[model samples]
Target: MASKDLAMGMTFLTQTVTGILANVVLLFHYFSLCFTGYRLRPTDLIAEHLTIANTVIMLSKGVSQTVQAFGVKYFSQITRCTVLLYVYRVARGVSVSTTCLLSVFQTVKISPMSSRWKQLKAKLPKHIGLSVFLCWSLNMLVNCIFPFYSINKYSSKNTTKIKYFRYCSSGFPDKITEALYAAFVLFPEVSCSGIMIWSSSSMIFILHRHKQQVQHIRRTNVSHKSSPESRATQSVLVLVCSFVCFYTLSSCFYASVVNFSIPSWWLLNTSALISTCFPAVSPFVLMSCNSTASRLWFKFSGFVRRR
Candidate 1:
């Protein structure tokens, strides 16, 4: 293999393996907590779902990209291409929706406990499972059209209106069909993203206001340690900011690939790299930010040291 191909394969392989392992660890942590009869918070449930989606994203996209980077054709059949791409798209959409849900849930969780807020907060936990189910259902329905248009890469030669996706190809439909597809795909994602941004901004404002209140009450310049809520808010903010940054960049790269008649290998690789960044990094971010996870990690490290 060329040095460039080898490097790309290694990079993707590293990302895929790291992300899968991290996600698996996170999942195990959650399951262990549950099995120990520990009550999981609503956010924990959402985070568990998000971790599952991230694992799917890594397996479907990251692993395939790594294989393709090594000059191996993984999606050799149309069915394989369609199924993998569809699953990846659905998982990605679920990740976005779940993140948005997490942000909104946190916003409600930390809001001032007015009567209205209290009512909504009380109901939110009850609905988390339903909300997640809806996310999966909606995305599955929205992206179902992809299978009909998907074709094997080798079959691209027979068609002029196909968009090449390295190992697979998708037939470009008529303008109207394309426009409708775009609207279907973009609407839910855009809406979820907007909600996430709004919730994040509300969280920032609330945190700032709370800080001001604390400072005024203390009437001193000395810094005080943050509460659990504050730390969690900060972590969620970091998470949302990272997701938005990586998602925007990935979208741009994806658009560029689609716009070109024949996207360069490097462009495709770059897009794939950008797409996997959030999945690869998010589990570590969650682990570091979570107090329980931190404590568990410290204990594990201490045990290993003693051994």
Candidate 2:
């Protein structure tokens, strides 16, 4: 037990530090580009927002998980729990919604000239700020119920059971209210998932058609470097796939908690661990997909090694 606790604490600490470093590096890359007089692309703007959201996720969720892993018991305090829960939920929701937007935006950006969505290219850039603003506002409003639904007291304290994750739950009301609250939370999430799926599908279709066109033009099976569009498509696919894998795993565990299904302490720990994986992994994904960030990271690493 002691060894396991120590391992978990180390894991949480490593994840927290690594995630923060990745985001900081990515942000610095963008700032460097701006300082050197390069105009920020729409994708760069979205990447900046996404990095900020990831940083928040790492800080809030990472601290909570680290504290829990060490059995700190600080979350047992109602005020602490409320603040942590609010920050985690708000940050997480924004991250999810932002990813959906990024996927969709990239899809539209790469759409063929004759495609229906290609018309959005001109107007989309103008709405980027509005869209990001609305995403943050909507998610903030969605998470407003955090205080109402989170308490430092365990569900075991109440006769009327409520589903809850590792932390204390405010013990929801009767069936009707619980159903309503669940709907409120799940609605935007479901919508975001739908948008991501649609955008991913569109991206795949466009890539396939482009590939066919190129093959037809060449009439040969010759190996060639990937086009910029193809590279962008591949990157989006990776980001979407990673998000789906971690999101699905964590969502299943979260559902178990909400349904009051887990009986073991280990299961709760597993859920917490799964929930934090995406945030911990996401910044690295962004850095890998972004060429400027990748180059900057390599340069920085070389300079450090030489020192």
Candidate 3:
């Protein structure tokens, strides 16, 4: 491999491994809590689902791209190309959808009793499982076209017609067909983005009101420490901000892949890195916000030290 390719491969491997481990630690934390007879909170349930989706996303997209960087020809078969791409797209969509659900759920939880979203707070928990299931199913079905469109790595005869990646190429969709497919693929993403914006905005409004109330009462209260609600809101706000940033970058990269002829390896590497970042970073953010996660982290650290 070229020096730059080697460097990119190493970086990709490091990011992928770190993301995988972070998510595993979170899953272990949640399961340990359950094993100790602690009832899982609704947020905990969402975190669990998010962690699993992140793990799948990292493995599917990150590992594949990393291996490709090393010039390994794993996606030579049409079936393999389709399957890998399908899994990556589906997992990516689920990650976005789950984050949207998480943001909306958090907003509803903190809404005032008379607020319209408060009506959803009660029903959210009951439907969370089903909602997650539907998200997976919907993405799976929508991205099913990937396999049909993915060209085998060894199929060079048709490369001139389609946009080819290092190991696989996308099917040539005529202008109208491509536009329609793009719209179809983007519907969930657009919906998720809209939900995140509305939820995060409402959360900011609520937090602002809450701070005003705290200001009025600060003179009488001895402690000015942040409440759990405040901490959680901060964490979720960070999640929203990070997702928006990363998701926008990823989307730009995707657009560039279509619009820019002869895209560079650096662009590809950057896209992969941006796509994996949220899954890698989100578990740590959740861990910081939850007491149980923190205790579990200390316990795990002690166990590691002893070993």
Q: Best-fitting candidate, measured by lDDT?
A: 1
**Candidate 2: where are CA atoms >4 Å away?**
74-76, 154-159, 162-166, 217-223, 261-263, 299-307
> How well does candidate 1 score on lDDT at residue 280?
86
TM-score of each: 0.91, 0.89, 0.91
Q: What are the per-residue Cα lDDT tens digits for candidate 3 across 25-102?
A: 888887887899988777778778888888898888878887887778775565457777788889888889888988
Give the per-residue lDDT of model 2 (tens digit) for 1-307.
Answer: 4988889888888878778777778888888888999988777777778778888888888877887788787755665567777888888888888888889889988888887876698789888888888878988887888776665454455435654455564566577777798888877777888888888998899888888878865566475778776786678777877787888888888777666633466677777778778777776777776787888778876886799
Residue-wise C-alpha lDDT for candidate 1, range 153-211, written one tens digit per residue:
55655445777666766765476776687777877877887888899999999898888
- TM-score of candidate 1 relative to the true fold: 0.91
Between candidates 2 and 3, the one scoring higher on lDDT is 3
| Backbone clash count for every predicted candidate, in the order shown | 0, 0, 0
Q: Candidate 2 lDDT (Cα, whole model)?
A: 0.77
Alpha-carbon shift of residue 63 in model 2 (angstroms): 1.7
Give residue 27's error in model 3 in angstroms. Answer: 0.9
Report the Cα lDDT for residue 27, model 1. Answer: 85
Q: In model 1, how many backbone clashes occur? A: 0
Global CA lDDT computed for model 3: 0.81
